[model samples]
Target chain A: MTFANAGTLGALPGRRDELVAHLTRPSTALAEVGCLLYEVGVSEEHPDTVFVVELWTSAEAHRASLELPEVQESIAAARPLLSGEFGGFRFDVVGSPLRGGA
Target chain B: MTFANAGTLGALPGRRDELVAHLTRPSTALAEVGCLLYEVGVSEEHPDTVFVVELWTSAEAHRASLELPEVQESIAAARPLLSGEFGGFRFDVVGSPLRGGA
Candidate 1:
């Protein structure tokens, strides 16, 4: 099964663009062992918020990615720019169009 | 540009499996004018809830798909099985690994 996560993040007032740049750079997540999809998008309804859609080969791979130096560094840097609590949804992906079928 | 929408839905008691089957059967979304990715997942942390991650060729295409008869029918069918309100997040995708470097 595909492993997925949907997270909503809000930037501090006036730090939206800078936060988006840091989050969307994306090199660290993609280079991980089980990385499948890592996408960053800015919400149309809220310019100061960001949405992250992630897919990994397995849940373990995803957890492991957090240990990488780049991932850790990025998180620390983006921490203060964050506004509130992160709303994260984790799922066991039963299917998707990207994989051709569910 | 990739137009994306993320929505969270809660399933009524004991209807998780049935709801998942109906949502992931996915033929109608794929056949739509600009549908790109439509993924439905069940949250591991909350089995009774569902998350839908969608990608379309354009915002208009996504709105148009909603007008299709099949889509309307599915929405109607899934309505009763749904619990609380749908929390939808709209976004403009800037990059993704699925698109080979976003």
Candidate 2:
């Protein structure tokens, strides 16, 4: 089973671009730490907000990446630029119709 | 700004409690069309895989709650109990430092 971590980064008005840059910078770093995919993009409807999607090998691997100083720093940097709330959850990929040939 | 739609419904092995009761029965009919605060409590580290979060007020009210044919027959009856690849994305909350305070 693969692991997925999904969430939203609610950015403050005028800070969306800056926040995206911050996240993308260390998100690149996250990609190097066995994080399979890291994507940062803006919403089509809500331009001020940003969405983040990540796929990692395992929950432990995802947690391990957070331990990296770069990851921590990037999050800290985003604190001030955010607006409403940043919330999401992690999951385990137990099945996939496409991949599993269901 | 205050729109967020997150995703991850990759379930297959053993069918994950019958696809979370067929997506919580229309996600409770996509929560009366306006679509806010719909929750499905059924994921903890990939225990067969299911995670969905939605907060909607726009994007044409979550695309008019999917044109409400009983939410498209509950996503076509969860497409054969799912596995892998159910992605997620949607957002527009411009600023929220705890609801625009910061």
How does each model score on lDDT? 0.77, 0.64
Task: Supply the TM-score for candidate 1.
Answer: 0.87
Best by DockQ: 1
Docking class for model 2 is incorrect
| Regions more than 4 Å wrong, model 1 | A26-29, A97-102, B28-31, B97-102
Q: Kindly provide the TM-score of model 2 when superposed on the true structure, using C-alpha atoms.
A: 0.57
State which candidate has the highest TM-score: 1
Query: What is the clash count for each candidate, in the order shown?
Result: 1, 14
Fnat of all models, as shown: 0.46, 0.07
- Between which residue pairs do clashes occur in model 1? B96-B102
| lDDT (Cα) of model 2 | 0.64
- In angstroms, the error of model 1 at A31 is 4.0
- Root-mean-square deviation of every model: 2.5, 10.0
Task: Please give the C-alpha DockQ score of model 1.
Answer: 0.48
